[model samples]
Target: MGEEPREHRLATPEGDICWFEWGEPSDRPSLLLLHATGFHARLWDQVVAALPSGFHVVAPDQRGHGRSFRPASLADWTANAAALLPLVDRFAGRPLIGGGHSMGAYVLTRLAAERPGAFRSLLLIDPVIMDPALYAGGDAAPVPDPADHPIARRRDRWADAEEMRARFADRLPYSRWQPQVLADYCEHGLLPAPSGEGYELACPPALEASMYQNALRTDPYAWLGNLDAPVTLVRAPAGPREGGLDFSQSPTWTGLGAQIGAVRDELWSANSHFIPMEDPARVAALLAGIAANQG
Candidate 1:
């Protein structure tokens, strides 16, 4: 956590996924951290900094986000689990500590269910896994094209990270983030524009929109029962309204913890969906406790 991590990239069927490693390999269980949608691996910098020493931490920018290869579309959410299999497998044959936020948490859930022994425990922060009923309807409403989605209109160009930070600093949801966290997000969230202009979002707006459009397409409940590792779910407050485009509202199902084999559910009444960004120290404390449990 003290020093910058060594960056690595792995090629998958979809494309290459970029990952970062901090600390040297040791006998202690390795820690794997995954970021939420539209976020890069570096967003966890603060959390990692607060973690106790001796952990070999690994964080990845899932496909279609950050420095990872981006396909034209990210409509198939399930494909991400498969894409990250190799990265997760690298920590196999030993106990590994896993922590993820939002969609990252959902992906970890899928992988944990598939290979229960690979994970020693899980810290899920406001996962996007909604009520099981939502996934049951085979005839769901058709999703609009990514270009037609509201997120597609997001400002694509930025003069720099500072400018991006200045714009979002006073905005809702983001305004709640720790100043350093927001700085990290802006610093690592942009890439030089392909047009050789200023800069563009690392995760294209259309691709981000595609992810939301097909959010409920994958059902992870079927695999939840197979998990043998203990899970700690940290839920944010339910939306003030049912839900429209409110990013601050929690999307996690209230019953998610009960569906799993061994789990503890927590309600973070004061926080929004972006728990890690809001309180990295709290997240690090929770993760440190999980890591301490390693035998």
Candidate 2:
């Protein structure tokens, strides 16, 4: 039988962070899962359901997304990491395995570095950390204003969940996702509009765009050596070449494994940046393996 998750909300410095928990509160070790920029805690539901019994799992909706309280402004990944510190503290006296996707992966990396003993191991799926060369001279190219970004301009309201699902069923990235995953996204990734007329994206477009704009404000490469636990980085296939930019591929820096203290890197050419939603079974297996090894 699949494990059922319990929903929760915790007070944090940033805001009230919402999360989901699986398994009993025993000494079975804990896994902390963080979702990507525009995703929620429930995004890991599939992975959590597939995990082995007798293990505790927690997944949080990051600030400014999902059911979590939204902050006025998110400075960078560091700020988000700091806000999530309390959740990490919950696993203080036990084995904690950390895993995340894209922006979530970046946050986990930062948190593990800042608190080396907080996690026993890490699984980073297509983390968005950029190459050091891109940060040479401390120069990051300017990002377009959030209001002007394409993501910010996404259609917010829909007649209902079915309408939203139908609209995205044939969309680029959403279209590629597994059917159940897509259903989950449509179901939990939206909320009834404040006006009660329709449903709108749980993660506001403007907030998501702002996050993308500040994606490079903090660099994780500098602290890679501080991590003492084993780490696995799963990267997606290379994106197609555009004029000097490739938006369809993994954003992780090359040679990241070698630079980190103890790391193993794997590439999933068939998956895109959304590895968790694309293949939760594979992700669950990876997390289960890491947890089992710690026994």
Candidate 3:
């Protein structure tokens, strides 16, 4: 199956591990794409197409979301190590270049810390991290669990793509996107259910919100010195100020690039947190260059 998708299952403590892979099998250096918390691997579709066919791309549906089964807590990421680590050897013998968004990026760093030389270069796009207090440390103020936050579980039924698109376009949080792009997001965002149909979020809001807080247990910064892989950090420049709104003040994630200078000697600033989907051509170009170095 040259350039065809291949999937495999691995028995893991979290449940069965499921991963989606594609691109030419003979592609020189391997590139693995990992998505953020509560996201499916398909999120990288646009970015993957612009790459050289000689490059093999493997996108894993990280544990607890997408086709992969979920465990009771976010800590299951560590348990799936068996399934994810061997992938480096089973697919590409050499340290493969890895890129991930948000928690997926965090996972890559954890792997690098635990298993040096597993990846050659690391690309982290708008990762959601900070001192564990945001989720784990003593100073971290406790926010009510999503099991209690209604906005966290705002259930909805979409009659069709237009309805979903229009609804998302109407919302302010995503108001940053172009209308057509927003529509495309809504279209790809929903999954079908039995009969009348229920929409499934590419990310469960509660899970998305919880992982950051829960991530306090793992600190990639403290362990970055151990990893042999070269790292690159990319982020957006501003906060609510750009949106002309006072809401949420400076979105705390805006300055991640400035602070992560040690692990990532360089940072690429973008216009928003949704960088992969927004200006993927640039990301693809960046990854293409990365592939060249490893090749």
Candidate 4:
């Protein structure tokens, strides 16, 4: 493990976007890690721990997650990337390797395209980009009512991190996670309750649900093929094409790898959509390789 990350926050109109930093800048390629929706940046602690020293690393809480601002609604998914533009610009000094998971990957794709030189390369881990067909013709899935969404119904309160860990230790997707990664998730995933008792989810259930409901609204295909940087897509096993948020399987389009000009597709059948959490060491190794090649 490396030195503990130093927490920092950047003020935004909505509120503040919290981020974590590690190591000092040097000639080496800088790394930025983006986490999946509903998950905070600290969830990447295990992966960062395995990374080599002497390279600057950053992990942000995005807008509506972790210690960041809690907006009234998160229906506009593109807003996250927009909010992160400044941070990306500031960290692009050295060659930057952007590593993102799921929604974070989607956000980085947008940033990499919008700000050409902001990223030297991208490592997209199980990004939630759906089949291009869904975005080509018309509107994607209709935004569901926050009140009626399944994720909205998730439990919001926990006695403590230990309780949260104990409750989810045997759960499906969580059970597959590396134990320490799961521990990191629980440890930093909670915030003090407004009532001054116990804790509530750092990402409110309704907001997280709203983000999911509008997931397909922000399509990355517009600039996906136009990206100048090399991209590596790590995908989980293909599951039934049927609908629903099946985290056990990947949500990435099967043909996505072939769609990009400079890309590599790696299908890891043994893991689920949470590849980083399932295997942080391998993810770290892959990032280190990309940094080495780009540096």
lDDT (Cα, tens digit) per residue for candidate 1, span 130-166: 8899887522657669998788899989989999999
- Model 2 C-alpha lDDT versus the unseen true structure: 0.81
Which candidate, 1 or 2, has the higher TM-score?
1
Residues 206-234, candidate 4: write the lDDT tens digits: 99988887887766798787788899999
Model 4's lDDT to the true fold? 0.87
lDDT of each: 0.86, 0.81, 0.62, 0.87
Best by TM-score: 4
Worst 10 residues of 1 by lDDT: 239-248
**Which is better, 1 or 3, measured by TM-score?**
1
Instruction: Estimate, for each residue in 133-224, the C-alpha lDDT of model 2 and write its tens digit.
Output: 66553325565577866778888888887888898898878888877788888888998899979899999988888787787766677787
Ranking by lDDT: 4, 1, 2, 3
Name the regions of candidate 3 deviating beyond 4 angstroms: 1-8, 75-83, 131-144, 149-151, 160-162, 170-188, 194-196, 238-270
Question: Candidate 3: lDDT over CA atoms?
Answer: 0.62
Check candidate 2 and list the clashing pairs: none
TM-score of each: 0.95, 0.93, 0.77, 0.96
TM-score ranking from best to worst? 4, 1, 2, 3
Candidate 3 has its poorest 10 consecutive residues by lDDT at 243-252
User: What would the TM-score be for candidate 1 when compared with the true structure?
Assistant: 0.95
